[model samples]
Target: MSMTVNPASVVDEGEFTVRRTIRIDAPLEKVWAAVTQPELISRWFGITRFTGASGAARVGALGTITWPEREPVPVRVEAVDAPHRVSYRWCNPCLGEPVPTEIDEAHSTVFTFTLEPVTDGTQLTVVETGFETTSDPAADLESHRGGWDGELDKLVALLESGS
Candidate 1:
């Protein structure tokens, strides 16, 4: 039995944010690991690598997420709440431009993954905000809206496939 997945939506109530909520047919612990663990995250999302004492996800952890044929985007863990929530601030560089060596506070957005246990599976909601500070707010919002759609779909597939 496959679950219905939802596309991401933009919530612009004076703040530019992209949000998506999906129900994955997997346990909460499995979902949490996919989002918090660097190795697991790299499997579903971009290739993630932390640049500090450890590569684990925790508050203030610095990292980069690289996609094929694209520059590595700098990332910083902003918050972590065990198997519940984890948020990261990442650089959102303009198209064809290289991302900063480190996360640029002035040109970055924060994305949060919030997970909840459900009767048959786990419900995950990703909220990415701070697009108002980007080069093009509308474009970035739409881009990320589509981005979350693809990225989260991979995550659902990875976990639900029993891998």
Candidate 2:
């Protein structure tokens, strides 16, 4: 099934935030697993250290995700509500290998994914904030804006293809 990829909306709120919402032709449970389970996440996003354990993304769970052709970006789980919401803090710009430390306050952002069951599928929304704390807000915001767009598209493709 073909679908229109949603474009990420970049907003400058003192700092900046990139938000995107996409509808997947899948159930909430399936969508949630895709976002929360490391095995599934890696298929569309990046390679993560998470072991796909349930309730493993609680606050303080720290790990690194390395996307293809990109450096390993440090991440720390901030909040999670199974099958519904998951939020994490990670390096924003991801400029180079090793992001100094886990979600540095001065160079990181918090990204949250929310899932809701819809009539024909699940609605997934991703909001990445905290750019105000980064060294270069504008550049990081723009880069992430494009990044989320592509990543989310990969997610939709992964789910729709039933792979």
Candidate 3:
């Protein structure tokens, strides 16, 4: 079944945040696993690996997401609500610089995935905040706006492909 792909929008009400809501032709459980599990996430987004405390996504779990031709970026699980919601904080501004050993809250952003059940499938929404902390707020916001658009579209295609 074909699904509608939604583009991400930037909300700049004092603080900068990127939000996107998309409907996927998949179950909530499946969507949740894709967003929460490192193996599944790596398939569509980046090569994700969680470290510290079982290498699973939970509050305070540490991890890194490596993309092609880019350094491994440090990430931390800030919150998780089972198959419903999960938020991660990462050092996005430090991309070109040496990969930080830890997340610098002062210069990081948090991206949260929220999943909900729909009549035919699941509705997944991602909201990335804290861009004000980055070195260049406008650049970071615009970059992430495009980033989510591409990334989430891949996610929708992955889940809807029934692979």
Instruction: Say which candidate scores most in TM-score.
Output: 1
- The CA-based lDDT of model 2 is what? 0.79
> Residue 70 deviation, candidate 1, in Å?
0.8
Model 2: how far is 100 from its true place, Å? 1.3
Q: For model 1, name the residue pairs that clash.
A: none
TM-score for candidate 1: 0.93
Model 1: per-residue Cα lDDT over 1-163, one tens digit each: 5745656655663679989899999999999989988899999999998876354598888888999988888899999998999999999676776678887888889999999999889999999999998888888888888888899989988988888
TM-score, cand. 3 vs. native: 0.92
- Return whichever of 1 and 2 wins on lDDT: 1
Q: On residues 6-116, what C-alpha lDDT tens digit does candidate 2 reach at each position? A: 656556666578888888888899988888777788889898765344544666778878876776778888898887999988884647534564567766789999999
lDDT of 3 at 81: 90
Per-prediction count of colliding residue pairs?
Answer: 0, 0, 0
TM-score of each: 0.93, 0.88, 0.92
How are the candidates ranked when ordered by TM-score, highest leading?
A: 1, 3, 2
Worst 10 residues of 1 by lDDT: 1-10
Question: Cα-based RMSD of the predictions, in order?
Answer: 1.6, 2.3, 1.8
